[model samples]
Target: MEEKEPAPGGLALIEALVNTLDVESGTDALDTEENRTRFGLTPADTPGARELREALRATLLAHAGHHPATGPRPPELGRLLTAAPLTITIAPDGGATLAPSPTAPGAPALTARVAAAITEALLAGVWHRLKCCEAETCHWAYYDRSPASRGRWCSMSVCGARAKMRTYRARTRPA
Candidate 1:
């Protein structure tokens, strides 16, 4: 998200993409050619690409019972619904493989790629477990590995503790 190295595989990609979007500022790396290249996005970054990414992130956050502090909730537009669909082939041994069809290209194509990754994660039942850190300035992307899957902070030692301290001070300070 900070123009750093892309996170690892699986749901990490989605996190990486969402983190590229600044939560409080609504600034997005996908909106500019320079930033897009820094984030490994093609030079053909599309208009409204940031909106799509925001939609995706909002949907995931909503799944975790977190509403964005600002911005309108994305409408229920359903699956990305791209012209280039993922190609699914059943293997001879009863396996299946999904690949992207070579139809759409450029920015539209990139959107489809991100959408496909999300679709794959959704099918694996792990999409709901990925979330953005709740701290306004430190919205890091992280996987919720907590046993109960109720984890809200990216790290209890950092964001969680800071939040707790703030609450404690607010409650105890002299009025």
Candidate 2:
């Protein structure tokens, strides 16, 4: 059989960024160390993850400053699997419109807010798993906790099966 596609770590970077701002899960989970790692976070408190999180916070704050609270922020903008291509515009009348997103001039505008939005969409868990493996050495990571919550491993052939085999051997071995 063909090998399964590897989880996109690059994309994971974006998703994790967004998940960090998840009004419900991300915010609540970040308050603790274990939850942070469980969410595949890279310790924003130190250098890696914390830095990104802070950067996102700054972007959101900047945007909020410009746009007064028409209504409360939608608890982290729900979830997005991809950087929506729609051009989100707010008319002076307070109405919003979704047209095609503008292309960045030259290479592209590296706006902080847009960057944050992209990252968040990646972790929105819209297209990927928010949780990761308990085992080391395996990058098999991506769990979709659907209604069944049947997801048990990043990849059964890699992480899940290995875990199962290890457990079986341990139980079968002479005590």
Top-scoring candidate (TM-score): 1
Residue pairs clashing in model 2 are 14-119, 15-122, 15-123, 18-120, 44-49, 44-50
lDDT of 2 by residue, 78-122 (tens): 222133344667899997644434663211122223344455445
lDDT of each: 0.66, 0.42
- Indicate the residue-level lDDT of 157 in model 2: 71
Per-residue lDDT tens digits for candidate 1, residues 1-175, read: 3343443455666676777776557676676777676444565454545656666666766666777666566644254545435677799999876666677555555566666776777788777777777777666667777788887777788778989999999999999
lDDT of 2 at 98: 41
Sequence-dependent TM-score of model 2: 0.36
| TM, every model | 0.76, 0.36
